[model samples]
Target: MLRIATCQMTSGPDIGANVQIAESLIRKAAREGANLALLPEMFTIMSNDPKDVLRLAEQYQDGPVQRIMSGLAKSLGIWIAAGTMPLKTDDPHRVTNTMLVYDAFGQEAARYDKIHLFSYEGQQERYDESELYVGGHKTVSFNLPLENGLDIRIGLAVCYDLRFPQLFRRQSGIDCFLLPAAFTTNTGKAHWEVLLRARAIENLSYVVSAAQAGRSSCGRAFWGHSCAV
Candidate 1:
């Protein structure tokens, strides 16, 4: 069996500080013999202001976030599924929330921009990610070669994508799904694990999740229950 690790950490508006924390956690996981390290969504920043995301957004391949994670994966000798970071686009008003996967040698293996943008309006909380993010239109999956000379197919999904099962259904023979989330406390408490379980059951595959577990810069609580199966 392959060893998978899900990192649970807090994020703030400061990307540098968040990267430090993320690196430290990934190093610990490596020391503990984890073959793969999955980071939580918005692992770098949790800003209340949309402008913060716009300001922090980096270009697809040349950004600091991608460079650092690529080096980390090579140096640490572990596959890293970097949860989600802001990538610049043609639209100045919006960015793409993207996941970049790096292999053990640090090469960029695959990229998946999140297709589902979450827009929630509740009594206490209101969010419209569509204003800040443009949705991705494609499904992405890749093959991971194990140490045993065998390879497993892995599918990708981000935070709000979990709610739609049809997305997962489109991909065939995915051995496991790499999901990174920053679910709100209320929704996560009620639906997180159950939904995860249901997805696994429906696909007859494994689901690995890494999540943010604390409050955002605006004091909105996140439901963090990182797990793998």
Candidate 2:
């Protein structure tokens, strides 16, 4: 069986501290013989203020976070999926929630910008990702070449994309799907497991998800049940 690890995190507003925590977890996963490692959504920063994301957003090719992940992947000889990092886009009001994939050699292999924007409102809760992020234009997938001559195609997706099964339908050739979500406690209790199982059952593919759990620095709570289905 293929080995993989999905991290459950509680990220804060501090980017440096978050990265340190992520690196530690990644190392642990690699040491455990995980061929592929997945991180949670907003793994680097989870600030209440959207503007903070823009400030932290970095260009795709050159960024401290990207460099670090690439280096780690190469050193460990594993595939690292740096799950949603804020990326610089043309719109100052918005950032791209991009997932960067690095090969065993520390080379950039693929990238996926989160396509679905999240918008929800309750009597006491509300959030609109479109206000601070623009949707991605294309679907993203990559191949994981294994030693046994078995190459697996993995599809890429983020939090809200789970709500739209059609988006996953378009990724016909993928052998697995990676989802990184920061789902709230309220919603996670209501729909998280059902949705994940549905995606896997419908697509006939494996689903690896990492999520943020517990109360965050922003006072928002997440329901974390990171798992593979």
TM-score of 2: 0.98
lDDT of 2 by residue, 133-221 (tens): 88998998988888999899999999889999999999898899999999999999999999999999999999999999999998889
**Which runs of model 1 end up more than 4 angstroms from their true locations?**
none
Candidate 2 local Cα displacement, residue 150, angstroms: 1.2
Worst 10 residues of 2 by lDDT: 1-10
Scored against the true structure, residue 161 in model 1 reaches a CA lDDT of: 97
In order of listing, the candidates' clash counts read 0, 0
Off by over 4 Å in 2: none
lDDT of each: 0.92, 0.92
